[model samples]
Target: MPAAYQPPVAAMRFLLEHVLDFDAQMAMLPGLEDVTSELAEEVLAQAGRMCTERLAPLNLPGDAAGTRLVDGEVVTAPGFAQAYADYVDSGWPSLAGDPAYGGQGLSRAVQIMLDEMVSAVNVSFGLFPGLTRGAAEALAAHGSEELKSLYLEKLTTGEWCGAMALTEAGAGTDLGLLRTRADPREDGSYSIIGTKIFISSGDQDFGNNIVHLVLARLPDAPAGVKGISLFLVPKFLPSGNGTPGERNAMSVGALEHKMGIHAQPTCVMNYDGATGWLVGEPGRGLNAMFTMMNAERLFVGIQGLGLADAATQAASSYARERLQGRAADGHGPVPIIAHADVRKMLLAGRAFIEPARALAAWTAIRMDVADRHPDPQARAAAHADVALLTPVIKAAFTDLGFETTVLAQQVFGGHGYIREAGIEQYVRDARITQIYEGTNGVQAMDLVARKVTMEGGEPLRRYLALIEADIEHAADHPLVPQLRDALALLADASSVIAAAEGDPDRLGAAATEYLHLFALVSLGWMWLRILAAAPALGDTRTPRGHAALARYFAAYLLPRAGLHAARIAAGPGPVMELDEELL
Candidate 1:
């Protein structure tokens, strides 16, 4: 069925070794001194094996079986529990975690590579650890010493998984509209009462306990978002010895019957006087939760990248084997891969997937630098770069990822639409990435409004400077000038959106387009870097292949930057003119 899923191990190693110089980068960061290229390669290789053997086979079966609520417990898809046990036993969850909390203390770049493999093979299975890692980060950053001592290790080790509970029926994006309540008690804990919807991995039978980071307002709290506070509410309260004791006052009210990721339990969580401890300072819950949300946003982007690569691989395999029309020479029957249109579709997907992988790797390495760089200036610079690119990665990767799946589906024609082919499943799974972790529209607005316009657009200026520097080095390349032009367009668009500070409508109108422009330029910048690194890739065929993809991206994809820039320059009037009741 559409050729068994294979991890892009060679491609990942190519980027890690030649393009990104990952080993040298890791050597610069603290706690990653021993992480070498050879070690990283071995880790990726082993992870690929595990995923191919243990996880890939589970993807379709998991989707078919889906998740169910047995009594009040959310039971995962078949074989998921054993797979998760094997995952934990293999020490994967601790790969990029903090050493103090039983993690292996590796660089996030390595972890991200592994993440891509897992997500590609089995996205439904990936959510379990993905959400737990996010929760651990939040708790590590803001939770009290006691909370950390009690919960951090379990979450880090995947002994007890974690979930984020921020959404309510009335509040999705607007946290201020939430009605969840948290009341303080005498024993330094609070009673959390709320119902959170769309909570991925909210409940699972695989892990010992689920540590839910719930958001609720206290009795004396102020109104709106400022009143909200984050609480660490476990499914089962930890006893005096840090073991699972009495069951907490919470239940999975229902499971969301969704379009995709059916194996992942998207629960409607109900907290009826659940005992919880405050995670951070009063009235600053959003600040704490954002630490997790920001991490999830980037991870979600990688999810898209993983699925995109999977779909491309599937379509390419099918095209190579499925005989169809004649070649240009009018031979008897040739594989569809010979067809110009099919080749174009496949190349387009490759053009996006390769550089997108590089971009994700680069961002992930920067995340490590931002956190662990010894120099304060280096840390601050890396942090700024990560902040500016997060929204772009989240929005663009998912949007294009979904499109890539559809393109892959197109390659198979009617066969792709059939469930038995397994291509349609990729399309369904890829759709949710664009919607969750804040929709792409929300991401676009964040890119234009807060990230671009804030501080007089300093972040955007610095990021563009990095691109310009890369372009300057690749002057001999044909795509150099075009890349420069796209960067300038992006800069100009940023300035236009920044200049419209007083007009909220202008920001809203330009946001999605502006994000698209930013993404194209960013990817173009990545392609330039890839082009420069091609000669050093050490193989004639590989260099030629990367060069072809780079050319395709410049010729076919980068031009969209202009369209988005034009839309951004159009202002908000055309979009705002239509009245709400006109229809």
Candidate 2:
């Protein structure tokens, strides 16, 4: 085995078996009757094997030799293309897609497990499958019957890959500023003319055809996002038999070298009246895109968790193996893990990793409910909960993920910065989680401005009540009150944000701290749920590490909630008071 990295079976099982309660979910979804914990364990074991065996071994080499571009095609690392082929042959992409479209009909929990595993082993490699899953979700949710029937199966089965074309040079987060245009043609199709940047897998040799879901404004359309419409613009046009035929009018004008995820090609696609068809209604493009965004954003949150998990493992292994200075109490030539400070760092890293992973996985479970719930009321409730949590999930988990990787790098002392070792890759890979899937800043805005502000705080009230209910259940624990206090502080922080809405500067002033406050409370809620599900000290294979890690969060992580709450409540005065010329 290559340096024996221990999977966080404890955290993984705690998430798979509790909090989201997989047993109960499987019981309800009869389609998954054959898919028991045994099967899941088997699958995860297989995932673990594939990740470590195929993916983990590539991290260092892929980083050393990165994905190269030649001519107009992007090349994956040697063996990566074949490994990706094996990934598809395993039907891993279909784990949670609708069975109607060649998926295995599993729930999102399974997808979460697969997500965490792939992310840990190789984040760049994971990007391909991750983006595809999100696009499949978008098509399933809003594509035309013809569109869905034609492309969904191929996408799910990995015959083709999916790409979301939303960002343009003029628009990153502000979709209203997008300059892409779509005009209807006589053949029940549209022609798109615009350029999209930051497109992942935009041009790759991994698949035969890449489906581009482009968002654009129609001719004579109104200004802003109101005129927006979604279009299915494939890289290649499909012939009569559903096989990709002629090259579309689109072309990859250029590819930008990003800070990380270099293995996943980031292209600037030039669409010059590309043959495309409108998806959903004319003026509802953003609405349809949100279907992809919601799921994709949560997955990005899990991406952060996965990177953090990788970081934690890399750090912990280094700790146990790398001999360092003597312990504070003269333990003598101790493993770095023996040092109190090192232990503190390792524990703190685990604290965030465990709960962050749990929250992300739970969010995916709620999404599965939104996908497969038997009752309408339950489905609607699940939808509301997902909407309420998605922003926080993406923002908080990814924020912590970045922090965890930093700590992991720090723990490596000098080895992390050196490219010969792969610890730096975790830091590099973790960086983009906060930048994409709606910047964490945008996520915070969505949480406070939209999700929380719904109907003057009905969503906020419902969320607060739910947190209080969790408090009630976990009251027996001493840590529960501290968490409750954090929730209350979050409420106050939200109130301050609401109070500042009229102040133009307040929005920008509170943006960062607003995200911080949001992360605190959302993580607090998640940690409480995780602690409540602490596993009994039963077996070697069982995951009972929650208690130790929960204690770590209580002492080290939870107190930061107070700081975030204070910063958010401090208002925009201090920030806004600074004269414009002071700099």
Error at 469, model 1, angstroms: 1.4
CA lDDT, candidate 1, residue 23: 86
What's the lDDT for all of these models? Answer: 0.89, 0.79
lDDT of 2 at 292: 81
lDDT of 2 at 570: 69
What does the lDDT read for residue 46 in candidate 2?
Answer: 77
Strongest candidate by lDDT: 1
Candidate 1, 216-298: lDDT as tens digits: 99999889999999999999988888889999999999999999999999999999999999999999999999999999999
* Candidate 2 local lDDT, 104-199, one digit each (tens): 887677778788888887888887888887788888888899999888998888778888899988798889999899988998999899999998
| Pairs in steric clash, model 2 | 10-543
Superpose all Cα atoms of candidate 2 onto the true structure and report the RMSD in Å to 1 decimal: 2.1
Give TM per candidate. 0.98, 0.95
Q: List where candidate 2 sits over 4 angstroms from the true fold.
A: 1-4, 29-35, 499-504
Please, what's the RMSD in Å of model 1? 1.3
